[model samples]
Target: MQFVILCKDKPDGLDLRMATRQVHLDYLKDVGGANLLGAGPFLDDQDRPTGSMLIVEFPSEAEARSFAQNDPYAKAGLFVDVEIRRWRWGVKPPAA
Candidate 1:
């Protein structure tokens, strides 16, 4: 199954996000179960990062949620709120 991982950063937590970005990316790269289809910081009205949005694919919703829970960003307390929604990918050709 695919899941949309919507993460809203804690207030003024951009520093934390930047600090753990490398580890976060590494974790995602090594987990090997979920696929990070698309992800980026959610910009506020002033064009500052207020949160994140990620589209991931896994074998099950549980797995996807697990990935989100164990993500380095979550562990670092960068997220004020996070949401996981089962997703359907009806776009064009899949990523190569």
Candidate 2:
């Protein structure tokens, strides 16, 4: 199933996020792999990242939760909140 991993950064987490960015990218590339459908950050009014959203596929919600928990950004305590939900691609689905 596909899941959406939504995360809100801590109020002062930009430095931490920037510091861990490359490792976070590596983790996503290494672990998420083909299961990663789409991912990016949520921008604030100043065009700075305030949170993240990732759409990923996994066998179960439990597995998806585990993946979210293991993200480098998560491990680094960059996020103040995280939410995981089953998702449906209702429009403009990716080409096969």
Candidate 3:
């Protein structure tokens, strides 16, 4: 199954995020495989990063959720909120 891991940073979390970025990237590298589809930071109104989004595929929901829970940013308490949800890639037609 595929999961979308969404995290929202606390207002003052930029420092924590920046400090933990290398570890986080390293963790991603350790876990990356065919299942690790994509990941990136989310920017705020002023273009400062405020959160993160990770797309991953795993055998089950438990594994996916576990993956999110173990992220370095998450472990460092950089996020105010985190959400992990099942997802699927599908075709979407353009709006009229």
- Candidate that would win on TM-score: 2
If ranked by TM-score, best first, what sequence of candidates would result?
Answer: 2, 3, 1
Residue range 1-96, candidate 1, lDDT tens digits: 778999999998989988999998888788733488877788988988888788898888888888898999999999989999998988784767
lDDT of 3 by residue, 1-96 (tens): 878999999988999999999999989989756668889999989998999999898999889888888889999999999998999866662232
How accurate locally, in lDDT, is each candidate? 0.86, 0.95, 0.88
The regions of model 1 sitting more than 4 angstroms off are 32-34, 93-96
| Superposition TM-score, candidate 2 onto the true structure | 0.98
Residues 1-96, model 2: lDDT tens digits = 999999999998999999999999999999999999989999999989999999999999999999999999999999999999999999999997
> What TM-score does prediction 1 earn?
0.85
Work out the TM-score per prediction. Answer: 0.85, 0.98, 0.89
Q: After superposition, how far is residue 85 of candidate 1 from its true place, in Å?
A: 0.4
Candidate 3 stretches greater than 4 Å from native = 92-96
The most accurate candidate by lDDT is 2
